[model samples]
Target: MATRGTQILNPRTGQRSVFLQTAQDTGGALFQMETFHPAHNAAEPEHTHPFQESRCQVLTGTLRFRVGGVERTVKPGEAIVIPPGVAHHFWNDGEVEAHAIQEFRPALNIEDFFVAYFALARDGKLSDGGIPKSVLQLAVLLKAYDRVLRPTNPPRFLQRVLMETLGPVGRLAGYRPDYI
Candidate 1:
């Protein structure tokens, strides 16, 4: 399980996350972290948390966010709240590194998902766009973290079909669902 002070670095995305209050610390009420995002960092894939709400408070530099198709630039001391099941993505286009305090309500296994995803990146198993290079790996990760994260494109039903079909094959090929 995640604990305060645990850190994960993703070189592919030039981002680092340090856990502040984990599920254990918060009695499953919230998961909090401090994220360091380098300048010009790429935005994450448009996605949604099916059952969790997220909030991010900018600490330094500027962060750009696209929430539910609306774009906004957030600066220091500003915060953005993303409701559950909303499609959103964020990036840092400023010349300086950006920092933010992020929180997720109804703490789930988000930290585990991050650890697994970043591990793949650290192991050089992800592409330049921060996606798993292998279809099997992608299936495994997507299937495992479906409740916490879901890609916005390709449609939800399509994703479900693919994950349901390929997930078993990926697991049979020795790709376990939980990397952490």
Candidate 2:
């Protein structure tokens, strides 16, 4: 479980996150963090939280977001709300680092996902695109965190099928839900 001040750095993506309110801290109602995104960083993979809505308020620099296929630039002090199940991606396009406060409602294990994902990224277990290098491990992680995040590509039904078929095998191979 993450706590207030818990910090994670994803070198691959040049993003740093500091937890301010964790799931445990709020009895699972909310998760909030401060993010320092590197300038010129690539946009994140388009993904959606199946059951959680998210809000982001920029603190410094600028962020470019593509929410539901509409792209927009967000300046300091500007905020954006992404409804549950809406595909979205963001990147820092300014010359300086971008800082933002991010919040998620009905947290639903998102902190756990960040802990594991960042650990994997730090240890070089993930690819340049932030995916696990091992297919089995990817399947296990995706299956376990399906409620918190789902990739927009490949369709939901196909992902469900792949996870169901490979998740068990991954577990049998000693891969756990938390990569760490």
lDDT on C-alpha atoms for all candidate structures:
0.89, 0.90
User: Where does candidate 2 have its weakest 10-residue lDDT segment?
Assistant: 153-162
TM-score of each: 0.95, 0.96
TM for candidate 1 is 0.95
- lDDT by residue (tens digit), candidate 1, 1-180: 668999999888889999999999988899999999999998878899999999999999999999999999999999999999999999999999999999999788888888888888888988777778888888888888898999887689978886999988999999975664
Best candidate according to TM-score: 2
Name the regions of candidate 1 deviating beyond 4 angstroms. Answer: none
What is the Cα-based TM-score of model 2?
0.96
- lDDT score of residue 120 within candidate 1: 88
lDDT at 47 for candidate 2?
Answer: 94
